[model samples]
Target: MSQKSLEEQIQQLDEQLSSSVEHQEREAKFAVEANERFARNIACFEKYYPQIATAISEYKVREDFCIHVTTTGVGNFVPKNHHAPIYGDDPISQVSAQVEYGIQHPTFSATDYTASPILEDDKRIHIRYMGALTKAFQEIQAEQKERLTVLPEHFPSAMIFGIGLGYHIDLLLEKTSFDYCFLIEPDFEVFFASLFCTDWFSIIEKVDERGGSLFFQLGADEQTFIQDLETLADDIGAFSVVRSFCYQHTPLPEIIELIQQWSSQYFRFQYGHGFFNDAITGLAHTVHLVEKNTPVLTLPKQKRVDLSTPIFIVGNGPSLDEAEEFIRENADKAIIFAAGTAIASLSKKGIDCDFHILVERPYYNYKVFGDFLPPEEYKKTNLIGLNTLYPDTTDRYKWSGVAGKGNEAGTFLLEVVSQTLNNKGIPLMPYCNPVVANTALSFAMFSGFKNIYLFGIDNGNLPTGEHHSKDSIYRNNLDDENEEGLVCMGMNGKYLPANFGGQVESNDLFMGAHFQLEKLIAHYPNRTVYNIGNGAKLKGAHPVRAEELLPLPEANRDINEQVEFLKSDFFEQFNLEEFDDTLLGVKAFNEICDHVLGLAKEPVSSVKEASDNLLRQARYVYAIRNTALHHLHHMIKGALLYYHCPMLSLLYTYTDEQFTLESYAKVNTLWQGYIIEMKEYYQHNYRTKCDHGKD
Candidate 1:
């Protein structure tokens, strides 16, 4: 009886063994197919995005992370640091349902849809028209909340926060497409695992077929994710990213933090749009300066003078009042350069700057300078500024030099002129922006100054709300009552860590300057920058109180001779006659105008179509690379983004197709008119209307 029972048990055991063997065979087959797909995906990335391809190729897989195949033949990831699977039992159904629900009940409110209106008192034709257009669109947006109930069929941009097994991406693409898709995976291991499970090759192909861009932020952590995204938005068009459908695949802590950072910093892309009139004015001023034989401030060929002579970059902040005695006592010890209206403050304190730097391009800046300081005060001070500085203002200084401002039409023109006359072009100043102190610091860095000292560059306000020094032109213009909260409101209207340990109120402009100063300071690792003021805390700068400031030895070198040597080493004078033929010809200008006009005039049936049209327009302008009209692209790109972003926002926000199309039509008509006006201005008036200075 026992022998028969044993035979039966052996038969059952053999059947079970056979079943196990088959399961192993099936799993091996799955692994082979997954590897094949991963190879194909890597090949696709190599063709399109080599960076991601290289990262995946170089990735070292974690020992504990394994791809677990479920009973239903779906892959799930188990991370080394995690206790459980990234996806539960049924990843397919779970992701499918998530995608379906996400599509039907989408979350679009994550972005700041508020449009930044052009509020500057600019008289340029484009600025005025865009301002009016912005106001009109804002009125339209005011009605969006009541009507925006459904999500649009398509979007210009899509951001995938996490890629667990990458199933949601496939599901998303199956439903709709995006002009630009940014896929962010903070953990390289997760992304690498997804390569085996998901058909990324097909995804890249589908996106490519639809004329879309796919950006991979593989291995990007929370700290750098937002900055990388911002940089991508900048390289592409910021307007194209007006509305993006954010799909969060996994709710990891890192992913959540990245989303929060993005939500907070997205507004940065909306600001700093260069409008048309400013472009024209900058061009005119630059051309006039070049024609007048004004020297262009350039990078030094070699470190001719000892940079140890501590150069002080002075700003007209309230901290200047406290540091006046220290600065005055050490005036001869260090070369002082006054930033913007700081000259007036320094003059009031009977301090003379070696160089007075101004950045604003308008004629009013020149007029204001004259009003603040008499010619006698700055007679010994050298004038250093952007190429767009008013030509008449340069005439009042002892000597003058200019540098090319980044992303300016005037800068491009100067580059062209330089290229035509000489084989080389000027390099734009790095981190020069939003404030005069930035330009001063950039100049100091560019000139190879090793020991740079920042005084009174209070990129914030005192607790009492005094932003500028009492003797500053701002305070002189205002009575005591009007002196409070004197600074212009910035993006982050809050307090920041101050140099001396207390908080100081800051705004967008000051915050931008603070960030730029930190970046510049970090950029020159060889230089030591000391901040001696109650300003916002700079990351890479050493902070010292005025009382603690160690006395620097008086420069052994002849200061005047050093200044002359710098002028000779880093300044160039170009022949104005050489630039006559270098200006963008009428044909090329008209061609660009026509391209924009064509995009504006294109018929759009849906919000998606209109969004694509605007994207195409932005891409077209930005794509005018290495041409004379390339600078024109920079000038127009910002205004285009400023106008197009809000327009697209309205089109997407309004659910009704008819209303959306109607709004698009009205905006398109206005855009057409603007382009026509711009074309006319460039064709008929550009050469003759240098009335700001040349005429």
Candidate 2:
């Protein structure tokens, strides 16, 4: 019972395990008996499980492989129907028809034989069992425990790579509080066999009825799985929700390895996309904050048509060349919404869009409008511009309607300034990226366009040295230099053509923007997004040729009349108030700064709690303004809450406590300074507005 004696006994037992000759002989006899039992068990299974046996016999079984009994009484589909030197050059003629038929270029290590066999109808049905049924159960339990250690900190959700016989999946569901499980098995026969071999249908239905769901993805390749997984992630709300993954080893271990790799890359891609989008929103807010004096125009929130109406969103991809004539001929049939530089490209083709969307704040946007046409001439076409856009472009035409990002800063700033001016952030669309194409799509979807068509919205770029259409502003910079590791899912779901110096490469930004669009559209089940871009297919968006759609009759009114209608609508309910209440505005700003700054200074014990409080405060601030900064406020609060889930580091290794301790220090400091600066900005602006009103 002494500690030292127990340690010595354990060491002695360990040595005895390696040194006992009688034990070795007994194990040798056990192996011989197990193998014999395995051979008999195969015959027994063929007799008892006649359905499976008959199915297997029906196939033209390859000559190289046949059933072989292992030391643990398990039958293996051997490469040569017997033991063969694994390192030898002899070809493996075939593998298990049921399990290995769909597996391409399968790779597995040589089998290791060790433990005794327990007979259950001679003990051959469980081919992976290495010992007695009880011993195998213990080993599986231990392995499951080890694997479960990797589960995220909360209720688990699982994705099992191979649902072998449904045993592991059933056990996993029973053990974990997983609300959903995705079963991905490429071999249809194995899945089908399991249906008959086990009570899989009942178990799946039971889980479904219990408020947990089991998604069966049978006969899917790695590519299809990736696409489906992203769609599922979006359906479930977030990529981070699926915390546990089970990979059952088979003859095709490499495929499982690739699945693991792709899953990791997919998560990283989501994180990067989210981070980049936040940065852009932050940049836009900073610009809005800096240029408070810029003329802000209110956009009209008119419901021109019902959700059943079709809206064609045009972009500046090279594919526009193919759809140009079709769009021009049928421009009046559907409301044409042109994206950023697409306006120029469409205009050059003699196609006029009903509403042109512009979101980027860069000077490059100005180049989209040809120098030949002055601001007055360009006013013939109605425009929708985000307030963050370059001043020259947003202020260019009288027909253009300027809208602010529905964000906290935009709404707050607008509220303080809009008390005197006819300015308020209008909800453009629910979108992650502020890209023109995404914005335009959001506009259509928000306006209840049930049928949406995308033209030249190439998620993938053209061949190298050819990115945009000839008339687009981006065409000038389409060189091979920017053709870095960009890739998108082509129409066939494989990677887009990557010909180095020959084909155009799509950067992650373009591909990520389109993916966000896919997620956005997934929520609206009744709405459909058809991609007419002859390049990469936008996932969730069906592809259709332009000729298949119906062309509309000529419009009763010309483009000028439409522009006039839009301009009139912009000022119909405009309420322009003079900046007369400067003191009142400053008092409200100071009160808000005090409320948030006080909370920010307090020590936070939990990152989640702190983020929740901050976000709540942000919402309260916006509500105090009593006007919407729809996109802007949401982004600001999201960024505030997302501090713990840093875009640069998404490993989830750091706990809330660790994150909060580290972040609360620097972030709170920045938050304090930012609040003070914003307060000062409001005071200065209020005084300026009051002085202007007096003048």
Largest TM-score belongs to which candidate? 1
For candidate 1, write residues 1-695 as lDDT tens digits.
69999999999999899978876876888799888988898898899888878877888876666788775677888865777888877899999999988888776633343444685665567767777786667766766545554445577678788888799998888888878888888888888888889998898889889898888887677556766776777777776565777778888888888888776666666666677777777877787788789999655576577677789889988878878888898888777899988887898898888998898877656776787867777787898889877777789988999999977877888887888778788978888887899999998898888888888888878655677788876643344566632433432466679877778888766766776787788778898988877777888889888888877776798777777777788888885653474465666778888989987888888777787888788878878845657766865666677678777766777667787788778777878888888888876654332343221
Please report the candidate that would top lDDT against the real structure: 1
Candidate 1 colliding pairs: 490-507, 490-508, 491-508
Candidate 1 TM-score, C-alpha based: 0.90
Give the lDDT of residue 348 in candidate 1.
Answer: 83
Off by over 4 Å in 1: 1-26, 62-65, 109-122, 142-145, 476-492, 500-502, 687-695
What is candidate 2's lDDT per residue for 1-695, written digit by digit as tens? 89999999999998887667555665566457545544443454364455544544454534453333333322233232325421122112221322232222222111111233454443211211222323423343343221112333223245566654444454444444345567777765555434322345446556756555556666667546666665565434232233344444343554476467555445332333222133233334334433534434445556333345567789887777767777877776667888876776777777777777877643433553545345654675666766555445544554555554554343344445554344443343466354788878876675556788888887666554345676664524433456432232233222443312233355556656765676668756678888774555555778676666567545545544444544454423233333234323446556766777777677666544454444445446445433333323332233233232221121222334454345345545545665565555545443221111111
lDDT of each: 0.77, 0.50
| lDDT value for model 2 | 0.50
